[model samples]
Target: MSPSPDTSTDTSADDVMEALVRSAFQVMGVMTRISAEHDLSLTQLRVLGILRDRRPRVTELATFLGLDKSTMSGLIDRAERRGLLKRGKNPHDKRVVDVYLTPAGHELEQRLTDEFRRDLAPVVDRLPHHQRVEFTRLFEPLLSPPLVIKPRVTPQR
Candidate 1:
């Protein structure tokens, strides 16, 4: 695990901002190395991880990945060529195409996820308790959209 930054002394707002960007880069550097080892970009790794559960329309995938549709198409094309994923007509809708990870792709994604979890556990564990909690409180919402509840349906006599 990386050593935690010393936060004991008085610090200015500018210092805090710089520290935040530095820490973020350190984390990103680690991920970049991991991605390189697997011959994938971080974005490709994320795509495989997302496809582990269920297949989705290409546009849906694009939206979820925060990528434009045309950009997503090229990414999918690359993955498809690498035999990591397949594109075909959606099972529920013949008109729409969905993407799915191949077995090899799923296996690779699972392995990477497991390894990251194990490797990051110590780093996360070293975080100050309040910082750890605050990090989750602050970032988890940014990662996911706010949950929306469905309206209840009524049965009429």
Candidate 2:
């Protein structure tokens, strides 16, 4: 027998969290495969995506990627050797270094982005046009400024 549909207008927070997490995983899987095709680590692919629009300082990049200075330096070193990115002195501060993508990196990033959209088309197409528009409208706010969760500290007795 087919499952009966309940007429519920409200969705619980748990349900929303579960849905978002599952969707993120699905998208990540697609990205992982695409990154592998380009012989790049997922983290490296992420760096390309991050550098696509903005040029940020090395320390800032490390912090955003949750990597320590040394580790972040190593990753950037590898990418630089591969000619995917370059580091230059920040115009305002000669002591600060900024990382940005090379032309090759930008081209690859664009191709990867295109592939991602193509791969995800089937899932997105499943939704009707109006629902797709509504989905984007609802999801856009969650992305801006990024999300951060800080640990809560309790006072010792």
RMSD of 2: 7.5
Which ranges in model 2 have alpha carbons more than 4 Å from their true place?
Answer: 1-11, 148-157
Give the Å error, residue 90, model 2.
Answer: 1.2
Summarize candidate 1's per-residue lDDT along 73-120 as a digit string, tens digits.
999999999899999998788999999999888888888888778767
Q: Report lDDT per candidate.
A: 0.83, 0.91
> Alpha carbon lDDT of residue 49, candidate 2?
96
- Model 1, C-alpha of 89: deviation from truth (Å): 2.0
Best by lDDT: 2
Off by over 4 Å in 1: 1-23, 127-139, 146-157
| lDDT, model 1, position 147 | 36
Among these predictions, the greatest TM-score belongs to 2
